[model samples]
Target: MAQQNGMVEKRGAGHWLTHAGLILGVLFIFFPIWLAFVASTVTQPEIARPPMPLLPGGHLWQNYSKALTSGINAPVALMLFNSAVMAIGIAVGKIAISLLSAFAIVYFRFPGRHLFFWLIFLTLMLPVEVRIVPTYEVAANFGMLNSYGGLILPLVASATATFLFRQFFMTVPDELAEAARVDGAQPMRFFVDILLPMSRTNIAALFVILFIYGWNQYLWPLLITTDPSMNTIVMGIKQMFPSGDDLADWPVIMATSILAMIPPVLVVIGMQKLFIRGLVESEK
Candidate 1:
């Protein structure tokens, strides 16, 4: 009885230690974001002074309003909208193209199919930076520059997504495909009715990742969008920095940073369940 009580005490102590460690880690990771939020709520002068206040100031509404209505270069509201459009376009376009390509690769057997799959896979080594010059040239020629198409089109062909979808599709039972064919379902009909439902969790997971990827894109948008109105929140934040001896607008910049985080945070929170399930749950 003493030994069992000792063991129970040991386990209880370990549990409390683990909780304490987790709380500390959370505070460590969250401190910077907390500082940013505090800064956003204060005035520029307050932020500029030494020993910045840890608590939020009374200027939350004012700073956020300023950021949303009239940012340094482009309005934050417009920038947020541009980012949303670009992110959604990239995520949806990548998923759609990847699904179709993977479906074709898995379901249809044409000549050099393996060769083609390998070719597509090999393009993963070539990121946007490697091909940026030519991609910019193409976009410029196609009149996609400074447009939503320019922001999304150059980056939408995701080899990673295609590879993931292809691997998933390969795991799907051939019996299902055979059953669909027996039912007189067309190729696309089988894809829409059968495959899409199975791939829902995966699609959710990829959407969260791809959406964040698109939202955080800075270089591509900077290269393509010369118009201030087309600037993403990332670009706007960078543009907010003072280039010369002038003081930076800490409050508004911090507010914009917080605003920039909201969409991705909302997406993750909203799709938390499906995202976790997609990553861990294996149908096969």
Candidate 2:
């Protein structure tokens, strides 16, 4: 009895230590953003000046006004709209395509079906960076540049999500499918009635993941678009880092960065339940 109590005490101590480490790590990750938030309310010079201000300044409204309506070149409102249109469009396109692809792989077996599956799995090995040039040419060839379609086409499918659903589909009971077919139900009917309902947790989880991925897409967007008006908030932030000894307006830049971060943070927070449930369900 004493030995068991000692073991439990050891585990309790270990768990507390692990949790403490996690809390410290989270704080470290968020500190930079907190500093940026503080800096956003200061003069551009003061924002960039040495002996960095530990506390926020009084120029918040002043900076907010300018940052929101930056200038003739890069208005915050327009860039935010583009980011929204691109992010939502890509998320929807990606989810729809991934769902259909996953469904086809799970339900219908055609020639080279395994080959197609393996090819998608292979893409897991090669990230977007590897085939960037080819992807760029393909997009340019389609004349999709500077359009919402350009922003969305290349990212319309997600291998990770498809694989997630495929693995989940495998675990679904064959009995249910057989019963549905006996009841004169079609594949589409079974999918709509049984598969999709059970997969909601995983789907919601993937939605959050895909949304974040789309929201942070910068490289392809930058390469495909030369129009400043079409530039994402990230690209606008990049543009603020002027080359050749020019000083960056840190306050406005930091303010702009903070503004861009709000939506994704809200998304993750909003989807917390679905994310956790998906992770748990996938384990089963």
In angstroms, the error of model 2 at 251 is 1.5
* lDDT score, candidate 2, position 181: 84
Off by over 4 Å in 1: 1-15, 277-284
Write one digit per residue (lDDT tens) for candidate 2, span 29-109. 989988999888877677556877879889888776787787325887778888888888887787677778888998888
lDDT of 1 at 175: 98
**How does candidate 2 fare on TM-score?**
0.85
Residue 124 error for model 1, in Å? Answer: 1.3
lDDT of every predicted structure (CA atoms): 0.90, 0.80
TM-score of each: 0.90, 0.85
Model 2, global lDDT: 0.80
The per-candidate count of clashes, in order, stands at 0, 0
